[model samples]
Target: MAASLKMSDDKQETEIEEGANTSTNASPRPSCLTPDRQALADSIMESVKASVSKLRRGDPPTIYIVPQIIRRVKEVAYEPRMVSIGPYHNGKERLQGMEENKLLYLHSFLSRNPDHRLVDYLEAIEELKDKARSCYSEKVGPLMGNEFVKMMVLDACFIVEILLRFYPRCRKMKLVKQQREELEQNEEDLGLISAMKKFLFHSNGFEDPILSTIGMVYLLGCDMLLLENQIPFFLLQHIFKMACPVKVPHLLEKMALDFFESRSMPWNEKIEMNDSYYHLLHLFHSHLLLTPTNSKEEPNLSCIPKFKLKPNLSCIPKIKPVLNKLKNLLPCSNKAPLLNTKRRRMIPHATDLQLAGFKFKKNEKSNNILNVKFSHGVLEITPFLIGDNSETLFRNLIAFEQCRLKAKFHVFTTYLVFMDCLVNTSKDVALLHHNGIIDNLPGSDDDVTHLFNRLCIGIFHNFKGSYLSDVKDNVQKHCENKWNKWRASLKRDYFTNPWSFISLMAASILLLLTITQTFFTVFPYYRPRSQFLIIMF
Candidate 1:
């Protein structure tokens, strides 16, 4: 009996083991958990609770370099080579070379502000640590706590010192002749500044010194403009104030504009610098786009002709409800629907448009690149200067608009997209080149064609809602008008010269005479066919 009981107990234990295994493997929602499983559940619950608590707070700004935006074609364009300004690119091995320069500049900046101690700068930057962190889209994991604060202070100081040295008036105040020479003695230790001095002063050593100098400056400027490589503008402002309390308003912004001002394309309207900027890149974008002080409307009287556009009302009712749902889902969305509109190429290629009796004129009235207008058979385009840094400048601007300028119409993207649509071939580029609409300082027509084509590759926007929508529709309608079509067909098909026109006229006359003869012969107003034949004989 005791042996039988032991066998039964063994069978029961094996059955319970199998049941537990089945429960664990069969479904994720188990009725019971072991000690180890319970511990894991508790840990996961805690983690989720922590994340939820963080989510209750607001998200950081969309200022980081989104991984999806970085394409393989020009991956280096979005990356910093010599220096990393902010925490996003900090501690990167490739960018470590410039850390020494940052430190040197930091030391110099602190020395200039003798009244304020280094601890004061650190304390001030530390106070803004949370605000600065909130400006980046990503969380600061590797660079947490004191490291983050130190990075901000050093980066801010470096920028202030560089700007002070770069601007004419600020440079005069910061470093006199003797002080500059003294600073230059330790040039080797100053990483980026050392290379910059060589690039600025000793470019004659290179094969193409002019091109080399331009390229170096372009690269340096591009490095600073990288999305991942930026510090907060407020930090810079705070540091600048600490350094020079008596400076005029917007001095920091002015210095930045001076540093990255495009030689080919200058700002159309004078912008009153204000503290309402995000960073240097944002400032540059605002300058180029003429972001109004108190308005969302872009003022381009030249582009705006006396033409009107009628919006498509037929589809609004159907799309409105869905769009309303999306708006609820996504607060602060643009008033316009997110569109994947394939914009109609209004004007044909330069040569084709010219052949169709449309004239190409260089529009000098407005400096805005988007200021393209068609009026009275004339297609006027503002001069677009393509130079060494145009690609870098345009790419960065487009990327910034993509990441930060939420819901706002992408004017720059739309303009580039329009240009890309117009220039589909080398012939189109050549026509624009001939008309002086495109000043190709970079290279050949093919190069310019490829550049424009590549620019709008991944760009998407609400083309219908853009400011140029009316202009595009007008140009398309003008191109497709019956009168214009007839004129173009006549000129292209029949009017090669006086000879062709004469030949066509002669052919027409001969055909008319033949038809008349046939008509008279076939239905003769005579006695009969036999009588007619006899009379003819």
Candidate 2:
């Protein structure tokens, strides 16, 4: 009976152990925790759920702070200097001075149209507040309801006032000599001329702070074009239309173009205005891609005449083909590959391309600065002006292109990369400058070279099927031509100067005379006197 009791006890212990093992293998149960820990976990879950609910569904963020990697290179280039337009740099002590100016602009905007009260503008911005908030990449917290609405109203009014003040000035400055004369003579332009004169005379004094000093105006313009310092275009348009007595379609864009226009870096006036621009910077970026009226016409390669050797060099024609054939037989390791690949193909630098008989020309035929074309041994690039503001303008444009989600073309980025490939050193800059392709107004060739080289740092783009790929490939193929290189070598080495040409000619004449004299001298010795005389006769 004691043995049976011991066996039953062992069986019960095994069953208890098996039940524990089965429980462990099943899904885990919630652990008993302290009240504080449980509260913390519940708070985190609630916060996550709230954040998930607040997430934007289909609306993509347009305005963004410049990426840290890109901004770290030139931090000041991305930051607003004179004024802050959007909430990104709002209320900073350095930029606070401009806030009073914004209010002053608001007062002036209200003064333009007394019929529309301040409440009307406030209500308008209130309606756009949610849409405007969605435009920014980050939630504009700390600025809610009336605060955000008030900020947008002030900023929008400030821009509209500035544009209104700058419109007449822009018209006066952009007119050519003939256009100005026509404006003076034509009855139609009388009202426009009068307005220009009035603004010009009035703006001569310091009545307005922003427009009085040219330097302040320039700095403010730069600040306005920053990627982070932007308000919505619709907001500006709404405020402008309400403030102005006359409702003119696209007058805001015209005034904006005029306000942004710089004599040092003029833009093509034939830009197409689009309603889809997120902000002023985007509008300006689009303007940089000028539409060519005659884009259907292919680049006239024959317009630039080919380099020709003097016809007097009779032996050159006969020997060139042989030299070219020999050169072709040699392998070219440095030549750019023709295959389309993900990697960006960098063409030879300006000096190197020049050495290979490639000529650089300013492409005045097209206003589109990105229209780089290579044909018939000529590489044509549109004239680009580098000024004090060039870096700020280009950097912001690049940052916008890099950051914006729907920006697939990357036109400015590709242009900069293309320029970077061409300009590796100061010598390259000098070459482009000499060719009238680059107008360096700000600094030396080294500075321009450094600007291009640095602008493309930390920027990424797949260059396989980019706009400049064909031009790049064509340039590479041109450089790889053996005949062109040989011709360039001959011209550079033998005919670089008049002295070298004279020496080559003298040597050639001496060699011919020597061979003739030797042939005549040997004929008298090898043949009989009568036979030699008969041959001479």
Candidate 3:
């Protein structure tokens, strides 16, 4: 999970670094996450501790205690005695330190022991799903309002990853059980797929929930191989199916493609290769490479039939009711948390830092490698500061990943990872965090770097989501271009295939027999070789 979060959160950090910490000398390459930064983080933690202490002793407990309580939850190993005393079995009201500790212990037992079998990450996600369902059923139900919805959304988002990646066997089992229980009911509770659509389309009123859930969903759905920085195995298999003489629905593929295409901030030019490369290539190939010397006219585009598609026969009706239910239940819509496209803004250099490649300038050497692979790693944005020389500009430290990758390789889906060396918190470089990493970087000293670090590693850490769009347009085109070239070569005659080679041999033998019979009948004196051999035998 942390592996997936780094590229995004680091971008959030780059924006604020210039104002983050100005001790006069942020020079050369700035010291990363220093002792000074740690000290500031400690002070912020102390303030939180103090605030929590005051709340625990207050006349009535505060409302926003969960995020803080989550920060301090006792993570104990579970024992048989404690299993009987499970906090989840009762209620959140009865959640004491020991019970929290015991639950943590159970989590650790199920999750961390090396001696135990390797339970899948998807199953781990499902375990989280079960806990989330409890919130909706017996415990803090919707009666508790958005708080209930918020926790469910957060946990659901985490599991969204599992569904997208693992496609758990239990998911099928759960659906069977649900259908059996509902019998005549119209809804199937979405089976995880619905949870995602709800967030992308529903969770608008939420300040933070909408950003992570929708974003992650679209990101994962795009293509796991590119996002995860791994090449797709059996690439030919997928390409053959997509490019087969068989037809595919244009609208469905368009929706899927458009979602992958949406991740860029508007300023970036739609890479000409996007839909153009294939479109142009086909046109160019017909006009130049495969044109008849006898014909002077252009090929008609309409000669090829348009692709028509039908939505999943099984899902069409299922999705309809689910969509309507989400609308009736949530009744809200909000704008996406995307940056403005029109206003052209460049990240200015910081106080003393030097970023090697700043926003695809003339001197750009390599693209930054910020994808799902680094989601768990620390994403620090050391900027080109207030004063820097040409030597510093020439010195390459941070690399950028210019292409949008689809995580289709090993992870569930794909999203783009855009790594700008000179990103700002509010201005230039951006820093981001894993879902839970934010708590480690509190800003007690109120220094900008201190605050930035906290925000990256510790604040609203690790909010996973579902995203269909990707930011790395270059990578997608690269992947797609490669797919097209491979597909173009697949238009060989059937006999070229080993399987068809045998069929061709059989057909040839049949044709030879037919020709010999015709020849014998046309010229009666002519006896075929087969007839002479048969008489001799």
Candidate 4:
């Protein structure tokens, strides 16, 4: 009876084990998590879903933080030194000093038309707050609702006031004078009109903190041009229209350009205001492209007059041979063939190209500084000024091209890359300076060289599709021709200086005399004395 009972218990245990194995095989194992951990996972997933939905509902961001690859090369260039316009650099301690100036300008703007209250501007900004927020790439969580609206109103007012004050300076003729007189008559007691008068007429005793110092004005201009330091153009326009009693279309754009213009940076006044601009920088860039020489399409080399070598044969006797050789070796007269097989990222530097029989000429006809042309053996480029703030300007322009997604051409970036290729050392910069193609305003040749070299350090360019592709390929083609190379070698080796040319001439005479003497001696040896004399006679 005991043996039978033990066997029964073993059979029951085996049956239970078999049932558990069957259940395990039928389904997957449950998650090994406690209740709290499961709840945390669910919450994390829900947050991710909510963020994705929010992003989907948002408009495409027009303003962006400069990419790390580009910003890391020159962080200071993208950072605002004097003032911050947008939310990207709004509340920094270093830039807080300009916040008071912003408030003062805001007060001046409000004082322009007493009929338009501050609440009116606030309401306008309030209505567009969400739209404005969507223009920024990152979430402006730190500045919410009222705070954001205030920033927009204050910044827009400050910009409008500055432009108003600068308009007289831009146009100082009868029309501007009449407008000023009318404004003074209309609102002589207003702070905005008084400030404009002080800015225009009282240059010697100008008391405004921001506009008093020249360095401050210059720094403020640089800060305003920064891509990160920009408010939406529509906000600026709306605020400008409200401040000005006179309704003028594109008046803000005109005032903004006039305010920013200087000797070193001359803007094309004949700007077409047809397209919508994103901000001040975009407006400036669009005006830059409006110059007659700058075309939206690829440049047609056939239309450009082929450069003819007009060397004075009277000055140099044997230069005709060299000129003829170069003319023969010139590439096709119609257009230089594109280098389709292999991509060329760089060309020879300026000094090297000079040695390779290439001439550099300043493109004075074109106001667009980015317009560069290559034809035959001459490279024509608009003069570029390298000043204290030039790097800042160029860096921001390049950063904008790098960050803006809808930018089709990469104009500034491509021009910088082309400049970077041409300037590798101080000698290259000096060559360009001597040719009037580069105006080194504040630094040595070495500084200009370093500036170009560093401008495109982390920047990417589509070499194959660049507008300067044909220019680059033609330049490379000119440099690679065998005859041109030989002529360049001859000129560099022998005709480099007067002494070398004289030495070459003397050596050629000596060789000719030696050959004549050898011929006479060999003729006498080959034939009898009488026969050799008869032949000579």
* Local distance difference test values of all predictions, in order: 0.67, 0.73, 0.27, 0.73
lDDT tens readout by residue for model 2, 19-103 = 5454444444467555565566556655554444445255677899899889999998988888988888888899889888887
Candidate 1, 195-286: lDDT as tens digits: 33332232122143212365655666777777777888999999888766243567688778887775466465577778778887887777
TM-score of each: 0.69, 0.71, 0.17, 0.74
Candidates ranked, most accurate by TM-score first: 4, 2, 1, 3
Off by over 4 Å in 2: 1-56, 140-142, 169-206, 290-345, 405-407, 485-537
Off by over 4 Å in 4: 1-58, 169-206, 291-345, 405-407, 496-531
Worst 10 residues of 1 by lDDT: 331-340
Question: After superposition on all CA atoms, what RMSD does each candidate show versus the true structure?
Answer: 17.6, 13.6, 32.6, 14.4
Specify the poorest-scoring 10-residue window by lDDT in model 4: 332-341
Over the full model, what C-alpha lDDT does candidate 3 score relative to the true structure? 0.27
Model 4: which residue pairs collide? none
Q: By how many angstroms RMSD does model 4 differ from the true structure?
A: 14.4
Local accuracy of candidate 3 as per-residue lDDT tens digits, 1-537: 875686655554443343334422344334676767756755665555544444444322101111322223211211111111111222334333333433332333223222232233233333444323322112333324444333333222222222222333454345445544554434554333343232122312323321247644443332221211111111212222222222222322232223333322111121122222111112111121111111112223333344456655342334445445444543122432112222332212221011211122111221211112111111222112211111111110000011111222211111111222122343222222212111222232123332222221211211133221222222122223322223322322222357555654655565556556554444434667777568658
Per-residue CA lDDT of candidate 4, range 1-537, in tens?
Answer: 989986985676566555545433444335765556556655665565545545656556678888898889888888998888878898999989989988877776676666789999999989988788878877765358798988888888888777776666536354345555566455443555544344333332225787767788778888889998888898998887776655446778887887777637544566778537888988887777553343223323344344566854354344445446544543222422222223354687787688777899998877777788876688889886778989988888888878774445587787888898889899999999999999987889999989988898887777676767778777776666655665666666666677767766766675556556656755676699998878879
